[model samples]
Target: MTARETEWISIPMTVDVPYRFAAGRYLTKTLTQLRDNGRIFAVECPRCRRIQLPPRIVCAQCHVRNGRWVELPLEGTLVAFTIMFLPLTDPTTGKPHEPPFVYGSVRLDGCDSVLDHLIHAEPDRGKVWVGMRCRVVLRPPGERVGDLSDIVHFEPLPDQSRPGS
Candidate 1:
């Protein structure tokens, strides 16, 4: 066969296909309280004073059990953000979503960390950046589960500063 033909025939038969997958872990009773109750909880490391979200059973920083559930505020600033260009399929629904979906790391008030979530703003490539304020959009009161997905994407808090001043 010609070189071009040989190259085509020698191509690997199996192409790696990457698709969205649903991943979850069964939470124990203690961790489950945050999701089902719409309350934020975190573990405060006694040694370092770092409040880790998702209330860990052990403290990774100090290598101890200096962790306990602590309530956290729902509103926080957007620490960072990105606009996805490729279409993403919702793992729950298994369908391709429109491109330009905004996602960001929101630093919930009173928590010394950030939780990555969706953004409820029209994603402009030029606008997304660090330190933009965002707030959690919680699920309906009656419908909540102890899961990261329980809190929907963050929405840009209203800009209280006067527009032209």
Candidate 2:
């Protein structure tokens, strides 16, 4: 077979798969609180006292069942980040996000874990930083649909200076 005429031909197909996800008690509580009360919730391991997002049944570090439920502050500090330049597919919608979006992990105040999500700041070093202060912006109460999608994005709080600025 010539290089131009390969033995195998490629065919593209679209999938119309439908499915549902079970969040269990731990996640259901978190998602419901966010959707109904406009709040972020986490769980802490009674042993290590490390708080975790998504409120797991057991702590990975301590291997202890988390018992304490805590509400996290809306504000947080950016601990790590990346400026994505590709059309990353969103798991929930099965669609690609617009390119050049700022995404990052923010350690919410009074919580031991960092929640990662889309950052609303410009995808630039000057605008985004490791220690930048950000606030979670959620959809309107009536518009919330009991999922993480209710979070619009993390926007930088006003009057915050970039590191070394």
Q: How well does candidate 1 score on lDDT at residue 147?
A: 61
Model 1, CA-based lDDT: 0.71
**lDDT value for model 2:** 0.92
Which ten residues in a row are the worst by lDDT in model 2?
Answer: 1-10
Q: Candidate 1, residue 121: CA error in Å?
A: 1.0
Residue-wise C-alpha lDDT for candidate 1, range 16-39, written one tens digit per residue: 667864322213432366556666
Please, what are the lDDT tens digits per residue for candidate 2 over residues 1-165? Answer: 797786778899988878887999999999999999999999989998888898999999888789999999999999999999999999778799898999999999989888889999888888899999999999998999998789999999999888787
Candidate 2: misplaced stretches above 4 Å? 1-6
Error of 1 at 77 (Å): 1.0
Show where candidate 1 strays beyond 4 Å: 2-31, 91-93, 125-128, 161-165
Residue 111 miss distance in model 1 (angstroms):
1.4
